[model samples]
Target: MLIKKAVLDGIASGDIDLLFRTWDAERVHAGSTQRTAIGVLAVDAVEETDPAELTEEDARRGGYASLDALRHDAETRDGTLYRITLHLAGEDPRIALRAEIPRGRELTALRDRVLHMGDWAVPTLEMIAAQPGVRAPDLAAQAGREKRPFKASVRRLKELGLTESLAVGYRLSPRGKAVLSAVRRATASA
Candidate 1:
């Protein structure tokens, strides 16, 4: 089920409102191209279904049933999510989605990196997670920096795969959530 790039981009970035708007626009603009029937149904289900549930059937049907369900599936199937995002982007893309880190040595390494980011990085990531749809300019204002530098700093977080860029701003990756939790637990116990 091929969804348009704008729609996938919106969903990945937690822009459900934008997604709805874009979906409706596409449905209205449904002129020449023969739309994929299942894709339309899946998006409709996402729009209509309250208390949505994911199932093997939904997977086979090949699209998300709801924004929550999509987020859940993204956490569980990060590679697939990433690939879909990349595919939607088309051509060589600068940014890509990433899978969460596995445990043991990699986790330990990441923890060390996180700890050594001079205290600000984790907190920044936490802030981004807390404000899901906030834009970069707003975040820069909050951080008391000009937008360009603040955006560059956020890009650094993206390089670590600890955060993702949305159409508007940013969200922590699943790995980011895990690292934040681990760090909190470690600090709390200490």
Candidate 2:
């Protein structure tokens, strides 16, 4: 549904090809070929519908309730999907009405211990920050953890809007960098 929202938001007035291409580019970047096909199908389902004429049913058949609903969800979201919307909107001025998704609530439990010598703190965030563009296995190795758990930690951070996925690896998001800085300061002071 988030994908559907992004696709709809990115679709210029009548430009199905442009929408498909944008979705394809994003999906390819994420390396989700299956998701790319799904997004393409959604776009195809409404290739003939103009943006202004888009109705509730059109949005549903496009896998959403309405453009309004999509906008609402996008507005409330603060993860990779929302970030992609921001990026696409920057790339194409025709994409409009994209609301910024602010960083989610702080992980209170993680505040003091974020950089402490622990299982899920210093290692995960430090490695990702130090090696912003490395693959998961390399990051895991550098962090002295295995591939599976390190990936899980990354996913957890992503769910908190603290990290983002790339085609090949992951990187701390703007929110991630801020939180990390705060964590460092807090830990140092402690």
Candidate 3:
């Protein structure tokens, strides 16, 4: 479930608590947390809601001025309407992970994980490090890989605090840089 940055901000500030999405099937469940640009969001509830059942209060909680505005926005998308209750959970853990440079055992573990990512890992990190903020499609093309899989690979790297997503592309996190440096040094020595 994609939440707009504005809505995310509203959630973070405790001004918004409801989200309406039209999806063929439920994409998120109660208790699931999503990490966003603002922070982490906790889904409190997911219920199938009839469009006619939505009230003005729901709209306000969803950051819309009126029920009509909420309905209009919801109708623009196709599928079953689900009312999702959410709150800002807290900070994204990866934010801290990004800043922490890996060392000793931590560095060894990170290096092992990267190595286990097969051949694409180090090169992908190197590519992003060299060309921060370049488009993903362009990066994928340069890497000679399909866009979707390339993005998935980047996401894996991100989960390890090895990459930071940008508006246009990606960059190495500080932790990522240290790990990459260590990997390269180990490879050179080997």
- Per lDDT, the best of the predicted structures is 3
Model 1 segments more than 4 A misplaced: 1-97
TM-score of each: 0.48, 0.44, 0.93
RMSD of each: 15.8, 13.8, 1.5
lDDT by residue (1-190, candidate 3, tens digit) is 7788888888878889999999999999999999889888899999999998999999999999889999998888899999999888888999899999989999998998897888999899999999999999999999999999999999999999889988899999999999999998888989
- Give the number of the best model, judged by TM-score: 3
lDDT of 1: 0.55
lDDT of 3 at 85: 96
Q: What lDDT score belongs to each candidate, Candidate 1 first?
A: 0.55, 0.51, 0.92
Residue pairs in collision within model 1: none
Poorest 10 consecutive residues of model 2 by lDDT? 91-100
- In candidate 1 the C-alpha lDDT for residue 41 amounts to 18
* Residue 86 displacement in candidate 3 (angstroms): 0.6
lDDT of 2 by residue, 62-100 (tens): 345457864455445343221211122223211111121
**Which regions of candidate 2 deviate over 4 angstroms?**
1-118
